[model samples]
Target: MSDLAISVRGLTKVFGGRRVVDGFDMDVPKGAIYGFLGPNGSGKTTTIRMMCGLLTPEAGDGTCLGFDILRQSQEIKGRVGYMTQRFSLYEDLTIRENLDFIGRMYRMKDRGARVDRALVDLGLAERAGQLAGSLSGGWKQRLSLAACMLHEPELLMLDEPTAGVDPKARRDFWDEIRRLSARGVTVLVSTHYMDEAVQCDFIAYIAYGRKLISGTPKDIPRLVGLQTWVVEAGEVGTLEAALKADPDVAQVARFGAMLHVSGTDEARLEAVRQRHPGQWQKLDGGLEEAFIWLMSGAQDNFAGPAARGGA
Candidate 1:
């Protein structure tokens, strides 16, 4: 418990009589880059809010940064920096103004020096006078991060922080996140990009308000128990149709000119591979394949009783 930055159990939240986050549990280690992953509308946001003291859980109990999530939420909030899915900063204000405003909101001491340092640290000093509204997606993201770090909080909860940023900008954002983790600041970020997810030290996959799996990036696919083979040929489309017809191939996914066929039974998958005339290479399933397989089997809680029954 001492080494954990966040620990929660049976965390539940309901909206319109439907459980958005149902009996969720999690343990995020201190100074670790933990990836919070899930399909859209899977309640990842609600869970993050509950863990960081932004939203109260109707059920469950836990602590964040040594403060009780329920009883000491204010204490927890003081130590956590939360960035929402959407940019929440004042767009009309300049980068420096936004950081200064955030500092004032926290009533931070030495606001000028702190804002100046944040500007330099995030490479925003040259553009300090630029209005946030005029900045690109990448620049706005950098400003948001700079604002979040003004108080030097011990924990950061970023919800889809790199969604619209370019490839280089995304890479730069992750580099900073790594630096913060190295300095003992725990970071929990949600992302849809597989490349970004692989950068995390730990990952948790969720769907339909339920946590399906959590582990180190290297172990997630193995833990899901999938055996996969990559098949490539000139007639990939034709091969894909034939592979899908085989009952043994539980999952068939097209990756450019190749198809990833996966299943729990290695022997069955091998049989399907032998039946197809292509360049079949047996390999361990990747995170994308594991997630696709996981999501395909998940039941949508919002569906009607008949739909759920059919599913």
Candidate 2:
């Protein structure tokens, strides 16, 4: 089999006469955790659905798990394990029951053994009889993951699986995902958290349904060509306001107690710094800085003056 689990181009999805996902392209290598990140309305979810064969794109050609997205959607679906944003397992059913139910849906030959193994793999064997609803968010996440793995899918698609999960739980869940990836399961997960996005083997940042950049987390910042400096001052808002009026200052954001001042051109950014001198430190930028730069350049395709609804 090819090393690329997903390879697609020009994936488009239109809703209400607006292209929510416009001419998107992505490539996820097999057994790698690929992070899909963007603002809420930037079409991250829409693009993943198209890639997973759940939502048909208006125009695109792609292969997911080696099945043609356009012509073999059913084949694609069968091999892909999808876990949605919400907790999708039955609340009333026990953990083992949920796994059994999923196994039955797939009509596995040894349903009982499959359920037992899933429980053991997910560390839910002790609580096999406990109701899914009663479990904590992290446990619920574990249950959802266990259910998805019941079919032994080649690809796993997770949509914001750590939204409400606690920090420790989120870390543990990601560790599990990495374990799966190491076992030759390709994982494509979407997340808003920058920390989580940085953990992926590869990342793709999309804005307004268009891809802004795709690369290793380390490569993205350098590729964006952002020059960043941190201003450590008692009054950041005052300095931020003062720099906002300057044309050379491309972006100014508060990072904890400090201010992250950045721009595309180093000379221009330095000029902005010289204009407002203080206890500042010039440092290498990271993914968060590059993402903000990407967002600033993206246009809201649906927020145009005509043909749109008002809030």
Candidate 2, residues 82-113, lDDT tens digits: the string is 99888999999988888888998887899999
TM-score of 1: 0.95
Whole-model Cα lDDT of every candidate shown, in order: 0.87, 0.85
Clashes of each: 0, 0
Deviation in angstroms for 38 in model 1? 1.0
Model 1 error, position 203 (Å): 1.2
Off by over 4 Å in 2: 300-311
lDDT of 1 at 250: 86
Q: Which stretches of candidate 1 lie over 4 Å from their true place?
A: 300-311
For model 1, residues 38-152, the per-residue Cα lDDT tens digits are: 8888889999999888888999999899899998988887789999899999999988889999999888989999999888887779999998899899988988888888889
